[model samples]
Target: MADAATSPYLVLARKYRPRDFTTLVGQDAMVQTLGNAFKQNRIHHAFILTGVRGVGKTTTARILARAFNYEDASGPHPTLDLSVEGEHCRAIIEGRHVDVIEMDAASNTGINDIREIIDSVKYAPSSAPYKVYVIDEVHMLSTAAFNGLLKTLEEPPPYVKFIFATTEIRKVPVTILSRCMRFDLRRITPEIMTAYLQSILDQEAIAFEPEALAMIVRAGEGSARDNLSLLDQAIAHGNGMVSAETVRAMLGLGDRARIIDLFEQLMGGAIGEALDTMRQLYDLGADPQTLVADLCEFTHLVTRMKIVPAAADDVSLTPDERSRGAALAGRLSMRALTRAWQILFKGHEEVARAANGLQAAEMALIRLAYAADLPSPDDLIAKLANQPAPASGPPPAAPLARPSGGGGASALRLEPAPVFAADPAPAPPRAPAPPLAPAPPAARARVG
Candidate 1:
């Protein structure tokens, strides 16, 4: 075994830090714009780099700083086309450059820090042609500090360049934002991240399963630094050979195959099987919330596949996933997939907050399973509308007995006679009926 002091292992994140924009992944738009800006001599005095954590905001800032004052055997003028590490590039990359000052606003977030930068801005560079200040987590600066910085930005010197990096751009005051060219760094896609990781592993002569690299990509969630850190941990966990099983164990992710099976069971209305699968996954160290979350993602993927059949060709999916997912996409209706997504989405939240997360997850799966067999609202309504109306009264009395020799269509039905009341004894002779009475003359004249 090598001595710890004699052989220090640099983690993949730091070992593979991008030296130039060309090496940066998943930031083509920003790189192209910056490259054009450099070529056209359109460099801004101040720039704000905004992105999520580990998405290369700070890395971009450092690269910009080096680019602004890069000096080599060729010349000392600023240029964006930095192919090789210039004289000042190494120092800046090492964070020890005299003219490139990297400040963590999280630690020094006060008016005094802003004032120090403001004071230093007037002076020309001592070593490099330009003096660059890279402030990270710039959103942590106080209001008064922002005001002070705004003043400096308003009248920056020709030799001064400001590079601000923040994870939360909304926290930064718009007044300061307006004075700087803002670049929004997008999250890296899984395909690009996986490819990049594979390339790194190849260069290091480290054997890695493609699935393992894919798992790292998903776990990284589009952050290059985060993905590299995860890759490092995975390599260590796998004893220097990254395998899918080792990566899965490290991430505590449920088996993708099992997840797909669970999804199928839920969609097929196999509540018992789905619940059993969930329990099995839990026993294997999968989180209940994570299970539901994965289910939700699977639901979304199925929906996409249903809409665009080409989605079945996604590279991230394992062979089993692709085959089973394609079958599922064909089997499920859009309505079913959407309903599953909604249930799983809500269940994910419930499991997260529930005291008994596993139980909640199981119940959520049961709901999805039962719901899968149910008719959608539109179908139910249409079914109801198509049903025949019930008769309002009892059936007519059976037809009177037909004559024995009656023809098939000539059956005779008898009608019962009406009955009249009968007096017990006849009255003495009936009284005579009265005659008509006489009328007045005017009545007669009117009759006439």
Candidate 2:
């Protein structure tokens, strides 16, 4: 046995990888279904596991392979309770088990590559109860390869069990998907992820501030592997004691309180203050794109709080976010929040492409600040509707007095003057008299 000091140091991600269903976090639903299936002896011959990266797709595939081949003193039976290492558990987990074959579809995507699997499916397990083939990134397989495996995959021998894992489930054909039991792994929520990380830190005897941990969790964005990897780097950077300042510095993140202040300034139409805050953050090593992304996230949070008041109580949110966010939500209209989100979201991309990220970020902030005072379309429409209508035309002409009639007493009554259409046509031109008319008149007078 190697000395403790001489043993190679493993990163937290691999060191804390879930070994069994009991240890897996944020996948209770899938685990429950599999457990029920195993309990009822209704195991499917093949299964396709799909999810985003770091959600344990490949891990679940391996776990399934182990369960299929699991055996102990009792007998050969597929089970989910992997508490006690079975006869072949160590070898399978170590990935050297002959009967449990693992293949990367990314590297071997050709039809010929799949032909090997087709040819080998007939062979029985050497030591384990079943021949388990685990193909990862199965969506990368060629169309011909998938077609070739269809018939066999649909109806494989009793001794053969197949497990496929892919991040892109849509890329897999419907025919292939129809033939296999599919399990969609979910992203780990922040609450569960936090508990899992805390447990690991406790076991490893590392100290971490809750705020620091929350920052890490936010950075992870609901991915277990990503969180673990970030945790590992954080530990090293913090010198075994994770602090919020160190993590913020490591991630190039602005101060949360300052970010909140900046958001408030932008939404309050204080462009100068917001730009100053932005410059300070930039000088402190905060990436402009990241800063804008953080603002966008805050905008989304405020929007959620406005829509669903319960969102403010989420475990992932800090005290500052809970209180300040609720206040912001109460004061700001949903339209304004949505508009801020749009501007910040677009600004993030602009910052990414700009020659000077800080300048781009400032420009985006200025736009948001100016837009803060602008009324939403709905509000503008409402304002227009509420205003009194303008005078349709010039006020009716002054009342006119009618001339007194033949009655003994004359009376005047108010009446509106007549109105005419604009631009009346001109009268037709008169014709000229002929000169011969004058000569006829003179002849009549002299000789008639």
Candidate 3:
């Protein structure tokens, strides 16, 4: 029988993996730092690139490998010579170089496998000027395997260099860490990752609405790879285009608009509307527990904006989101917002563990809604100060944080209202009174 393999689909994650520093997103600081080192010809003999999965640790290692073995079949590499179009650098990127060897430590974690690398140092490269060995997932190497590799790594030929990449840096031996320069790749920010995905969409001529892109980036959770993979799934589901509805369904996310709508209702103290929105989501076949988690994350994002306005700009939020978020911010007292967030997260745990997730989530949301009416600390302090002191209690101002400008809370830093002094009242003119007659006693006056 003929083999019936399914057609392969290249997910966005793999299809758009950064091929070079220029293509890399959200790692500008690390990229710039590395570029400076390269420009100065201060490259080290060994390097350890550490980061979470899909943040481009292995990719950075490959780039460094190309930087060392770079050449110009068509043009010179991007080294000091700078004569070439950087086209020759393409070969290294394509993994066609003879001198650059990539080893997957997860698959080949044995003393013998490490010994093979050690034995290769005696010979010069067949073509390239330098030989680079990239070991990925380096933390997986056995202790004996690491020891076997260490001896060769410490005293390799001048032309030989090592680049190790790992998601779990803590698991890597400290002795191995000390042998090489290290760079930690950050999780790509939502802003950078969204821009990256949009650029790819434009390149591929895929129609993606802005809201759809935002959803995709949010789903990515700071992993460029994960975002792309999700985009791929979304593209297939939507026939090469992405819309908010299709993406939400594919990701099993509740409609973001619905989520914001519910949040707005909750923030605005319209508990009825919020409950209706929840009912609508349930009717739409959304997993209630997932909805709760997504809402919690949404609240977290908005809360971050309180401390840093740049957070909203830096995150991937639809334009409608900005307006909605601002309105919610206005309605929610900071104290209540904090309490709601805590409750939502705690409820998420409860929902996850409960037999009926919907009930747990509903209860959690209702609790949040109920807590929304509570007054913030500022209002409470103001109320206490203006009210009469209890018969048995000390004064309210004694224990309160009484700012010099008493109208505004000290923590908020708002300027106090101007308090004007009254002009002194004109002295009342002295009133002249008739001299009092000597008053007789009441009984004598009555007798007279």
Per residue, candidate 3 scores C-alpha lDDT tens digits across 16-37 of: 6666677777788877777888
lDDT leader: 2
lDDT of 2 by residue, 92-167 (tens): 8888999989999999999999999999988888888999989999999999999999999988999999899999
TM-score versus the correct structure, for each prediction: 0.84, 0.86, 0.76
Judging by TM-score, tell me the better candidate of 1 and 3.
1
lDDT ranking from best to worst? Answer: 2, 1, 3
What lDDT does candidate 3 reach at residue 388?
Answer: 77
> Model 3 lDDT vs. the true structure?
0.79
Give the candidate order by descending TM-score.
Answer: 2, 1, 3
Off by over 4 Å in 1: 1-5, 395-448
